[model samples]
Target: MDKDLNSIVQKALLGDKKALESVVEEVKDLIYNLSLKMLLFPEDAQDATQEILVRIITHLSTFQGKSTFKTWVYKVATNYLLTEKSKKDRKAKEVSFDEYANQIDTGQSAMIRYTNNEGEIGLLEEEVKVSCTHGLLHCLNPANRLIYVLGDVLDLNSKEAAEILEITPSSFRKQLSRSRERIKNFLTAKCGLVNPNNSCRCKRKIDFLIDSKMIDPHALRFANHTKRSIDMMQKIEFLDKTLSVFRSVPIIGAPNGIMKEVRQTINSITF
Candidate 1:
């Protein structure tokens, strides 16, 4: 933790109610996004974020200052997500890039309703990008999925990622490299976002997505409303379009009302 945040933690520990709430607010987005990516559904992510916050509150005093507070929070988070992963049946069907493309291609004639609202359309486009990229992450197993998210999407360094995962830097790097190559190769081969030669694009698939009920314009949940459209298309070199596509999607923000709900939950707890 930085000295300022460390001071906040000291105040929080001293039974300052506002300071404790500040601690929850400080890490809220980090925990929420981590759960969002790990769980792959907004409702599940919200639940996980609340649960993780409660765990943090329960164990806050045990934080020994051995690692930055952010790192420790992530450690608590990853452990919770891992345990959640283990409780489920491990076999999530892997959708190949080709399979995903074909699904869109075969469903094109299903009568997608075009909206006159440009903003809604743009939000839909962004929704597809984020959902697809997050789906790609899900194609990896839980461990590699978390590793790739930490090292690549979140841009944590090797030491920081290893600390969150409780692994040596070498091990984290190894998993991240393999995960990256696997995703890159998959996207390059089948995703039109990377290879212009391929026959899929977000605009072209909007019809199929609507027909399939994969996107609802009024209920768009993943599009980042705060940023401008131009900011969404991150520029990578033409040759590195796969990475560019991954980079282009904006970070999904927490839903409205979650922060207040979290604060209330934390305050209600005896701990």
Candidate 2:
């Protein structure tokens, strides 16, 4: 997609309609793919894609080349999709996980996942599927999820991900870490995914702080022994069921561009 956007953006900005059209053609697939990942509905995704293209055309003049054209275009597509999602959520109660699975339409496409060189370890194919679905939903509300998908799953560099999100690279990393924790928590609760390495790693860190007297042992005691809380066993069982939903439902199918089209259509035309 980046390869496709280069000359197209340069030529399009130079007042070449054909070049601009070609650029759209090149990135339309990407725009829509990401949109569908973000929006999860073909109609919504299509609108978002079309609207993004129009915006790209309008903003061509303002694209100062601070980032690649693909980055700018991605921001356009994702930002619009996020806005539409927020608007809809504000209008009504949000969907539950089951609702998300049952209501969503998957035409056999899968979300690309990222793997660490540490290898699969405890994560099996089924685990990946559950994690992806849970992660996508975790990210659907904030555009941050898409950013992680681009950065983590796609293995895009921080600068590239930052460019797409319109945030500083450092900021992108921070949010990405938070997003990772968020998805992990979501999955842990949904799939009984202990992620022994990661969990034990966290436990070790916590223990280190305790042994070093960095944390208040009293607080730890209260959190674990004093307050009534969901037992670890129950939590694991809950997450296992949650993870099961993805195996049954599937995630990472198609992208939407409907909002993109609408934005393009409704906005004032610009060169």
Candidate 3:
């Protein structure tokens, strides 16, 4: 795919209209998924994806071929995400892992006693599970969060991920280890999905999540999409079974009308 993308990128740099559109089509989903994991909000992810695509198109001429086109795209996208001030403001709302865990435990007692008349509690449970896990990721600062997303969620190797982040391989491995251990320790102590003995269950938290407006039953985000099964994940011997919860998230696609919007942006560009 990178070989074909590199050829198309070359044509795109030379001002081929179809090649530009193909470039957008090929990388839109990748950018959107990465953005979604980073932002944890679908709307924010959509906006970031559009901006990143525009940056990629405008900077197409800067490609030096030192890396594959896909890796270059990741580098561009990660740079935008890392430095965006608005995104930094969003991260400001993040809570510490201990605070988040305490909230979950406390909320379990305040949970409204409601009945699942619509028979949708199952879906609601899934939403709570996904939302809580995504929220947990916010405990990490942006840099560490990016590392976790790249290494664990996206399954990028340390060397490849280091190149994208422009860090040494050893630094990347060390940071990834720290991030993974932090998450592993938290999940082991709190998440019932990761440890059956843990008291926190998704079903038990749904009422509180809904009552607190943490999740909207009417507007289901992550749960409504098709999720990747655990079996589909790469067989990495070192990956703990508990961490599969993050890898099993649904891969969100670019929003409708994105292609049209991207094409308009491309047409407006001089090259």
Candidate 4:
């Protein structure tokens, strides 16, 4: 944390209402984005974000400042998400290699292709890239998912991630390596975008998705209305180039109005 943020934390812990409000405003996006990635649904993300903000406020005094406030906040957010994942109805879809391969087979000799002149193809590809990559995360257990998110998606170092996860650095690295290997093997064996042997194409899925009423072009939830696209390629450039496909995918952020409400709820509190 910078000196300015450190000062805000001190004031917030000391019962400065404005400072507390400022803290909420400053970290709202971080909390919301993390929750959105973990929960993978807008409504669930909204609820998790609100709960996380309240937890941060409620536990502000327990912060020892041995680590940066941002690190502490991430630890809190991770613990909550892991706990929520353990609850019933939160079980992630398990995709076996056979099942994954079945989804990638185009059936016919040629896979469907779309032209850029229509404009909708680009939007569809954007959605496919984001959704497909995020979907892959769900195939892993919650612990492995957290490791992948912290180590690869969010690009935190092993030491930092281990600290946040409260695990040994070696243990964190081992889990992260296994998670990467599992995802890489699956992608290489199945996804055409990642491997030449695979025939699956995002363009082909667009028609099926639209016909099935899974995606509405009129109101695209993941790809539109954002100031900037979350290009994981640019963000994770420091990683191995062979795993660039995962890095090229995007992670959607929280929708609008959530931040304002969360901040208000935090500011209204006496603490």
Q: Give Cα-based local distance difference scores for all models.
A: 0.74, 0.52, 0.81, 0.71
lDDT of 3 at 152: 88
Model 1 lDDT tens row, 1-271: 5777888988877777788888887887889898877777777787778878888877888898999999999999999888964475244445665666566466443223676577776676677767767677777878888998888778899999999998999999998999989888887776666777866566666777777787776676577543532244545444566666665555556666677766776677663
Where model 2 places Cα greater than 4 Å from the true spot, the runs are 1-4, 88-140, 185-271
Best by lDDT: 3
Residues 1-271, candidate 4: write the lDDT tens digits. 4678889989988888788878877787788767766666556777787778888888888999999888899999988888853473363465665665565453422333434454566776566655666667777877888899889878889999999999999999999999888888887777666665666666667666666565676767566643223344445554354366655544445556666766666667775
Best by TM-score: 3
Which residue segments of model 1 deviate by more than 4 Å?
Answer: 85-98, 104-113, 224-231, 235-239, 269-271
RMSD of each: 3.1, 16.5, 2.9, 3.3
Expressed as tens digits, the lDDT of each residue in 13-119 for candidate 3 is: 88998899899889999999988878878878888888899888888889999988888999999999889735443643667998987887966742436654544
Structural similarity to truth (TM-score) of each candidate: 0.86, 0.53, 0.90, 0.84
Task: Flag the better candidate by TM-score, 1 or 3.
Answer: 3
Cα lDDT over the full model 3: 0.81
TM-score of structure candidate 3:
0.90
Per-prediction backbone clash count: 1, 30, 0, 1
